[model samples]
Target chain A: MLGYIDKIREIGERLFTDGKVDVVIGFAKGSMPMMNEPMMARSSGDLQKMVWDGNCGINLANYLTNRKEKIGIVAKGCDSRNIVTHIIENKIKRDQLYIIGVPCKGMIDRRAISKAVPGEVTEVIETRDSIRVKGRDFDETFDRGDVLQKNCAVCLHRNPVIYDELVADPVVEQTGIDRYEDVRKIDSLSTEEKWRFFDDLLSPCVRCYACRNACPLCYCPTCFVDESKPQWVGKGIDDIDIKTFHFLRAYHCAGRCTDCGSCERSCPVGINMRVLTKKLEMDCKDLFDWEAGLTLDKRPPLDTYRPDDPNNFIK
Target chain B: MDFMGIERDRLHLSWISSAEATKFIDVVGEVTAAIKALGPNTNFVKNKAKAA
Candidate 1:
């Protein structure tokens, strides 16, 4: 990943030197194995610590959503989509941000790594090519593509859809992998079965709000659940409260979610939160035939209506 | 007026995909035409006195 490091250093130096940005938010080598830590560099000296490689999987856009300061960011395909959504929703100003777009084949999942090689993974060594995990007795070498996230298997874009700088040559093969099949299968289930699935899925949520906090699209001045007056959802995980949380989150994200998949990745309990957004994505497609974050000029689907839209709600 | 009870000049219909770039333009054209035909959806009510 020397190319990645080189690009980060070059961009960081240029941004700091040119007074283009006050902060550069990128990934630094994490102290823990198989983890990439988010770093905010204020000066060229701190740019030395910035690195990028196969394991820089965590979506960094989640951290940059609300900051008003001038900033630069390292965006993968998914992260770029999140940036587009934020700009469209008027949550962040595009002119204040400089994006260094990097092509990605998808970063490796740390949990998947632990599963593939049981026992203590002392360190992870990743290069511009492959990853080798050092552990008890077995130092397994793996191609970077072999252990990508499930969501990345059918990535729609390898290059950033929007960027000011390109770190590497784009890998442009638009794989037509439909993401709605899982949502469709779940949709076909009986109402009872659906209830059972949600019951199982949300039971583990400790109301930590990590998923909500980590989402870039969830930038609201005041979240409804946090409101004390007529408190929407109580501070516990009952069936009703958990169901309300997911429903409200899904409703709030209607026509606004870009399918960045950070909410799913941030969940410590491993709830398949992508299922919620995937279903919302399907609804937006089927009803309004609109996808979020592609453009800033158009209004969101739920915020507007046509005279001849489906009239199923009429009495 | 058409057989489906919609006036040809008054009605607009479109089929679109999620990724289509030009569909928004099509929808906006149709909606603006429709809105011009029928007045705005809401009117300004400065107060209850204005409503009365």
Candidate 2:
């Protein structure tokens, strides 16, 4: 994974020197371990700050919304999909983007490592298949597959769906993976059990909108949670209000969500909000035979109406 | 809604013309029965005491 940084810098340099793009967006090593932050390199000198690794989990496409400048962005499989989503939604023009695609090999779940280790992790070293974590009092090695973020573990699209430049050859996409196993487990639960499941799942949320802010698709100027005209939801952290916020947010992304796992990653409380979105994603695939952001041409199922559209929900 | 444990019958959507009063009445009856069978919606209802 570390080897990709040199190639990323090489591409950023060419894009800057050739005057093809005004800025190159990529990741830089964060102050702490497992916290790579997005960095926008404006010149060849700035390219040295760019880095890539399993820690580059935050979706870079969130920064691309409504931008007017010609941008050269580093995109993983999910980020590239979101770029396609942005173009389809007219958030940014396709011609203005110089996509630098990176074949992803899943991002590390820092929380899992934190749980496994005895102390705060100060450094994380990644090789092809092993992760070495070092902390104040202890050091440990873990297989990469065991600590991958849940979405990446079952990700079927490791190769970017669209790109102008490839950092390396596309990695083999995972096949025969049951992406919706957890969703199916929840689906089989009784009504009361399901209600309690989400209640417990979301009880820790402090109404911090990190999940909403991290999602590339949630580009609304005034999110429903903040609107006070009719006061759709209460300001306090009431149970119903929290449920309303999550439920409506999931509904909004029914067909548009790409299962990027940004929401889950950004949540301070570590709530797996992906369960709600993944349920909707499963429904979209089962009913409409559609996946989000695979192509630039086709409109999302929710965006267009057809005579054969499924109305099974209607009484 | 059903996935989140809201009873599937709690919300109903249908198309009926203004002229079709009979169809409207039938749909309303169905909706009423569905909700009545599920009892009061205790899961999502805001707790008045907590809010106050």
Candidate 3:
């Protein structure tokens, strides 16, 4: 994945010189290790600053919402899926994007690395199958597969589903992965146990809204949390309010989420809120046999209605 | 709601025509019984004093 930087720059430079795009949205090295930030390059010089590595986990699709100018976006599998969702929802026109597709190998879980290391990490180096972490007092290496972000570990669509250009050949997708094991465990719990489980899980949240802000699907102008007309949720750290916020946010992403893990990646509290969204994703698959952003021709399950749709829940 | 630990029986949805008063009464009785079986709603009920 480190070798993708030069190819990205070459494509971005050509796009700028040809006047084919107004900006190229990609990733630049972050000030800290394992924290790459999204960059929008307007000139060829800015393209040189772009880089790609396992640390580039932030979804670039979050930057594409409502943009009017032509964009040359560097999209991984998840980012491309979200871009397809954007196009399906009319958030951005498909024609305005020139997708430079990347075959993703998965992203590193910085939190996992922090937990495994004894001291504060100062540098991270990755090869094809392993990662080396360097700290002030400690240096360690671990198998890359062991520290991948939870979603990426179970990812099935590693190659971009939609693209105008390819940076490299599509990588082989993973198989035989049980994607809903956690959701099933929760499903088997009693009502009281489940409630207690979520209560403990969400106790660390400070209502910072990082999960919501990091989500590309959370593009509503007046989010329900902020609306004063009906005052749907209180702006406090109350347990019930926190649960309500997470529940509603998960509901909002029901049939649209692509499991890009942006919400979990951006969470300051390290909450795995993807549990909520993934449950809904699993239900969408079980009931409607659907996956979000795989195609542009059909509407999402929740967005459309049919006579034969599942009605067992209606009694 | 069920996935979040809320009892599935706590909420009910049914289709009844406006003129079918007997069906509505029967459905209401069934829904009431289901809620009664689930006991008091203790999970999501916001504590007003704590929030304030």
What root-mean-square deviation over C-alphas does model 3 reach? 1.1
Q: What docking grade applies to model 1?
A: incorrect
Instruction: Say which docking band candidate 3 falls in.
Output: high
Candidate that would win on DockQ: 3
Task: Give the TM-score of each candidate.
Answer: 0.80, 0.98, 0.98
* Order of candidate numbers by lDDT, starting with the best: 3, 2, 1
lDDT of each: 0.75, 0.92, 0.93
In order, what are the TM-scores of chain A for the candidates? 0.92, 0.99, 0.99
Which prediction has more favorable lDDT, 2 or 3? 3
Q: Which CAPRI level is candidate 2? A: high
Worst 10 residues of 1 chain A by lDDT: A306-315
All models, DockQ values? 0.02, 0.81, 0.82
| Top model number, lDDT | 3
Give Cα distance to truth, residue A164, candidate 1, Å.
Answer: 0.8
Tens digits of per-residue lDDT, candidate 1, A210-303, equal 7888788777768888989888676566656776787678778877777766676678887777777777777788889987766667777887
Q: In model 1, which regions exceed 4 Å deviation? A: A127-129, B1-52
